[model samples]
Target: MSTSVPYFHHFQKDTTGIERPVRFTFPFCYDPHELSILAAEQVQTYLAGQNDFIHNFGLMDGQEGLVIGKMFGVLVVQDQEGNLGFLAAVSGKMAGSNKHRYFVPPIFDMLDPEGFFLREEEHINQINRNIELLQKSAELKELRENLVQCKKHEEQILSERRKLHKKNKAERKERRIAQQPCLPEQAYQELLEDLIKQSYRDQHHYDVQKEKSTQQIKLAEDALNHILDQIEELKSERRTRSSNLQNQLFDQYHFLNARKESKSVLAIFTESKNIQPPAGAGECAAPKLLQYAFNHQLTPICMAEFWWGSSPNLEVRKHKNYYPACRGKCEPILGHMLLGLNVDDNPMLENPAADKELEIIFEDEAIIVVNKPAEFLSVPGINVKDSVQTRIQNRYPEMDSPLIIHRLDMSTSGILVLAKSKDAHQFIQDQFIKHTVKKRYTALLDGLISGKEGLIDLPLRVDLDDRPRQVVCYEHGKPAQTKYKVVSIEGKNTRIHFFPLTGRTHQLRVHSAHQKGLNCAIIGDDLYGKRADRLHLHAAFIQFVHPLTKSLVQFEVKDPF
Candidate 1:
């Protein structure tokens, strides 16, 4: 029997009424099934008490080394004999090793001492050390300094000589102009010849001095170039070796599907996007769990992944929160591994606003204000073309430029304004750009808060790994600000009013859920928090200057929730 068979853990508690899912959990987006959740709980218990490995999860104050939280996953499986159990795996390496007793082993163990990866990596490190020593050597440093000084000295000498020559020429020209009328013809010719001779002598001197300085600079530059040439050659060699090693590593990562078909990381990515595989391609928890189950002949029922410790500085990750697989690295790999197995339908493909209607609040010759319902799209999407813009164009065929001035999130219900003419669009858009337009939103937070009102100044950017989801990134994010006032407290929920100062994608949602902001997710925010029937956020009021009237116009809508 394979050594990995022991890693399969049987459920310790009674699972009497737990039902099995008919389809496998969609790795991209899903609610954790009961079996998967139970397996994850058992894995968490083991993590809390385990003493076999050492990793800093930032849970304690005195832990050494860099504190890095990790994502863990569990797969509910049934063996050939119908014995129910689960397999555990973590993303990337844990405790500087991939060989843990309770977790499934990595598909390719590059850290093994006997592996080719380490051997090539050591060779690369030696090249780097040689380059560093050369760069720091006193001889190379002196050569560089000498070259700089030589060039400066050459320029100074040439400039001084040119200035002297200019002064002498000017003096000679004045002497000729003044003395030409005073002297006789023979005397004047003699004076001009003498001046010509003086000019030739000065020119010869400047040329000689310039040659000497040029030679000195050339000698210094030659010496410096010799060392730089060597360094460049070493760098070129290192780059070639690194590229070859990365290609070899990618070739070694072969993934298996449920149908027993195999494909390497390089080949799979090439077939999908015609690009190289991203870093940490097949090392995530989902791929490792699926690979192990397929190799062991275990039937995969469902799976779930969750964060286990402190959140990363660049991304928002709460402890013990379930998350979907990342699209950048794991999506392509999982798309291949989940083959031959029935999976749940992707909920994102379905149009949520198919049955919703757009209610017009007010209309005029230049603009129209409408109450957009929850789950309705403000604009057309890739799969769904039915949106507010499309509907407006259909209703008013003669309306030129039916421009959508601003947008609300597809899940958010609110008052949306549209322009019927180009002039009106530009006028209203200028107000938004200048931050003169005022907007207020009503939302129901999932938790209660003590503060009546406060300002949130967290910056936001899209999580590149997961599309449509936003993260609080201070380094490369746009400024997003919001002011909120608590309206009422109902049971465990709190109704609040949000006044946005700047507009950014998912600005309000991330601010509500991020720890640095309110630390309380808005109700029914599926991306950042738990999903409910619909998002509780609604745009209640909007105020802006009218185009034709040039007067301040405002509109309001009552929140349904």
Candidate 2:
């Protein structure tokens, strides 16, 4: 640590365009990596003292609980020249300074009502409100709707008049042909003429009404179009004004790089491929830490982000555990900000699965079932190349087309089915698609469950921003169903049996974790619950009618935990 830094000055220009010294404590400068190690060690020591969890994770019965909330830490660094800083950020959220006295304040302090940025934001919001109002204006809507209704009614009236005329004409012709000749020729001609005149009168009456309706409708439509044009013109003007203001606001958001040079929002993003600034550029914890350091001329060393709140129901997070920045949110922005800094790798993907032998439970010429160990992927995935299929291919060098029939979560352990022949694969796959294949699993729930047994039907879809994780959404998700029965209950835990009626990604884990379903995640589920040595859920049993033999087959494996 440098003893030289007693104090440092940092400033930001307000909405009034006045640059003034910012009032916040500057973190002490140190080796970033060294600082990270020290901070993590300190956090670890503190966690060890807490009874909320056990330190020995990844061991069955050795580690027994979870701690809620994630924490973020930073190690301020200083270079020899100390030109200082760049703007950057990490994934997750910030622990606000107001809530935690030891924490740093937000970059813009948006909560400050008197702040210039907040005022500007309010102006932008007002513009948005006006645009919304224009879109839903009742007066404009009524005018357009009335025009549409009038036009439709006129068309219907015209068609009805024409149909009646056709019917009358046919009737008149029928009378002329069926009845013997009328009284006198002149009288008959006169009667026919009269009949034609009556038809014409009906047509004329409706046509007059249609013309009046059309004229009124046209007037209303013209008014509506004018109003629409005015709204569009206003919207265009607002967009131009908004764009200029936003561009100015973005320019004010200058970030520091490792070399301690400031770059405006426009300069940084526009330099590379003309991408627009991310919606929330300088708001994240990493950026705030970096910005604070650079403004105060502190060296950036090493930093880390950890989740501090209750884990989101769908995404995996452990309180106090260190993690990497989310790739989707932070990568591009940080790529521009950390132009020269030597950033560390993401700690999450560092642990790749090693070669584990496939546990073959059953094998036939048509089909084979194996018990896949947890941490091994059912099939190859991005960043996960060595999977069950690759291992199977190695073992069965002579195997024919598409041996894999079904899959399991990489973190889940259980029975995995594989086909030896293409015909067998199709037959078994057909059974799954038809819901004829039945599978049962055993899981250890994190907490006591309310129900002894029940069916869970949840619609699940992938969370695109966060890969590999699935979310339960009724609107866009696919149908997933599971039947669970309580097997036993232990201290702070419940044992249960799950019979899945439909197969979906993370179906069992999501079914257990989602609030609507079991409401208790499987114990040791890192993505859904707390991180542990292994995910406690396992595929224990499976049954289906044989494709080749035309006989039913059921296979069950004993639960390891």
Candidate 3:
């Protein structure tokens, strides 16, 4: 196997060897030969000093990067001539170094002002501005005002007619009431005659008002329809123009992959079974590394990618964590690119021991408490069903009343509480809701914190694009609170105690990993920190009022680390 250390050198290629057509593809700016030669030294330094496999992160406090990132690198190999060079990449978006001396250039940079996409986009913007200006057209404004005036005039006439009708009704009621029980023949006759006259007058006035309203409304309707027709015509014209421009822009966008083959937007869709290009294609790290290699005729070796900076709100990402090329996007395109090249299997996607035995710590008729091992799932997942709930169902087939009430991260190992009866389950869960259940977690933070203890109040939301990864977002996030205290210092690593107030998903993990928060990812965190055998976070202690006995009961477990 080649050494983990990076080796970079120039591998000259003929510029006149292949001619590319005039097409708009992702812009890549880097001399493959020059980059390989330059980037290898940094790779070597990183592998030799940091990625020794013996030296892991989160062990010492006050270190540079506790949540160290994974690196996806390409070591372009050409064994025929005994020439060597390497290219480097980190997973996700790194804080700095996208414009590093050694990195490959982007496929398409829409940020350029001269770019056709940007120019076309400006056209679309101008079209929108025109549409807005059209809404304020004098012709349309006059039509609207005429309609409003017509409606107001009609309403005023109807209101006056209603008032006349009301007066006529009141007069009729008064005349009838006066002749109620014992009315003289002459008096009754007079009231009847008077009421008939008033009714006829009211009816005549109402009919005149209605006729006037109908005529005015018809005229207004005809006028309004003409204005509406004009508006719709204008909209249709704008839409057509916009659609034509969009098509032109799409036609102009051509993308190049690792094969150094350029294809238009339509061609790419026609080639693939998918209706559209997968999201965030061409821009990912894997494609960048591969494209750089293919352009220089460099052979593919092995590649690794790591993430840096804050995790996106949708996906599960941690700084310095290794992640495979996204399957949805990179797979189909890379499948075409890496057709005959002997590529290594991605280890990041492999799951060796998904199912493991559970160790029960304490059990009773009301509840059962167990010591959960790391790498074991708490509940059944969409893809994997080897969870604590599944295991319990398998172990206790005859007993099924209450179920798993709480959850722990699959990478976390510690005490877990389960209820045997529905009553106990509701009571226990209620305590959690009321914040009466006190829970304490122990974690080995990657960095040494300055303050011994403090509170972290940050809102968290799951990254929809990446499951199980949470991000700190104030606008759309759940309120999360965590109180932490430094337990002990092991070399540079600090053992800490966590008291979480809200049970948000990945609450503690996000809080610790976020820069504004603790900025210390738990040890062995694949998503947020350096990967190890297991995440160094455990639920150590839990105390709550007993449902059956009405007494406070507490449970504690020893730290595995």
Candidate 4:
């Protein structure tokens, strides 16, 4: 009856160069030094008992926990390459060797539980206080709601009061008409009764509001006391464990709770007008739009999940990996947030006109298409030196600048399109997003090809270390398809036409280089082709619907090379 969770998987290339998967489990925690020896022993025992293939043991990062009032990490075998060199700091010491001849203490030596308990005590106390305040505020809010209800009824009461006043005035006005005053005593008695009733109703409504307020106050007080008691218990326990901890109190780690809100106005130059973040302007590492919204107390509507990837701000959520020892958890303490503006803000881009020349192939009121050469950027970077977009802007200063609806690889030279207005940009962008638009490319390959036309369907995912290079991953990769037709076959080069149905990072290069027994690779693809002048793929044809006209439009260009 073994109870352990498998957190990671193992993979290796088979004889045919195809990836094969194997699963393994690791202990929740492991001692760094003894993990290797223990894992080796476990492997030997497993072989002796069951004679299973048991290729290797799996190990993972160390975790911290408390058992029977003592703090210790679990020691377990790591899967594949369970060498001591791979052992990292699990619970009680800094990762790597701490053999430096210095007065400083090892990192993990300071990670005792005594200090953590104290910090937990403080946090509990603070939370309890916050809960009490929240309760009081809620009570006040309820009272305000009641007051509001009373105010709404005031309109009806005021109307009735006016009607009564008018009736009394009319009766007085008709006194001359009813000169026969036999019922004067009766009329006076009626008036007195009405006055008494009005006074009673006003006093009753006031008393109801007061009573509700008093009841709410009592409820809030009770909740406050309960929260206070819980905090007190936590504090007392922490105090008792203070001796076992390296420090009396654990260092407080602050996690700011971003408040959610919306804004009506967004300044082009400044942030949202009304929202202000917990700290002004620069606390988070997000785009300007995100930062501005954060500053204004507007929470991010978007959630990002990060790993070892190129995309920014993608990180693990709080609830996903609660264990303190997880790598995802450690990365946060080491790397803070980085901030920039939207896609248009290429802070690193310089002026494009300073370097290579840009050739505008087509321009109109709706769209501006260019034959962008290689080494020229698709959009402006920080300083706007020589990006395709900047060049177009610099050349046509008078034309309302075109917005980049999409992007192309910087090293890739091909036909590029830009929208003149937001409507056009949005419309074209939607087509690209839906994969409704058609894109054709011309590429010269590394080897000859005899196929007239063929389709390749291989899933693609980021490589482990070098994410820019897409790899074949049948398990986790996204579906990608490309159709190719051989146009001509030279001695060692094959010119081909490619049609990609899906848009991934490097779908064409990865698919063409698949181990399907052909040496053909796109020219100039150093990552995939290894040694090439350039990736010979060119964007030759683009077709989509016109944003304003709703009419089908298409553009094509002959390969310059």
Off by over 4 Å in 1: 1-4, 126-144, 182-187
TM-score of each: 0.93, 0.70, 0.70, 0.38
Model 2 per-residue lDDT tens digits across residues 1-561: 233333221112111232212221121111234335444555445444545332233323434444224435554445346522122232233322222333455555544567665676677677678768877899878987877887888788778877887887788778766542755878777777877787788778777877877787788789788878877876787788777766766766777766777777666667753777766666666666666666656666556555554555445555554555444334545565576666544433443567577788888778888999988888887666788898888888998759889999887899999998888889999999999988889999999988899999988998764456688877889989999999999899999999999989999998897767787889877566655667899999999988788899999998989
Which residue runs does candidate 3 get wrong by more than 4 Å?
1-82, 88-105, 108-116, 131-161, 176-279, 306-357
Writing each residue's lDDT as its tens digit, candidate 3 over 1-561 gives 232323343434432333322221111111123333334445545554563243223335555643444344444444335454456654333433243444565555544567776676677677567657657788778878888998998999899889978987987888688676678889788778978987987898789879989899889888778767766776787688667755665564455544567666546655775456544455577777766666666666545555543444434455444554555455555666665554444332333235466888888788888888987778876656677777777878876666788999878899888887789899999999999899999999987888899999989887643445677788898999999999999998989999999999888887887777887888887666666667999999999988888999999998989
Global lDDT of model 3:
0.67
Candidate with the greatest TM-score versus the true structure:
1
Residue-level lDDT of model 1, residues 399-443, one tens digit each, is: 889479999999899999999999999999999999999999999
lDDT of 4 by residue, 442-467 (tens): 88887776678988887788754234
Ordered list by TM-score, greatest first: 1, 3, 2, 4
Per-residue error (Å), model 3, residue 152:
7.9
Error of 1 at 37 (Å): 1.1
Ranking by lDDT: 1, 2, 3, 4
| Alpha carbon deviation, residue 416, candidate 3 (Å) | 1.3
lDDT at 96 for candidate 4? 30
Tell me, by lDDT, which candidate is best: 1
Overall lDDT per candidate, in order of appearance = 0.91, 0.68, 0.67, 0.48
- In angstroms, the error of model 1 at 299 is 1.5
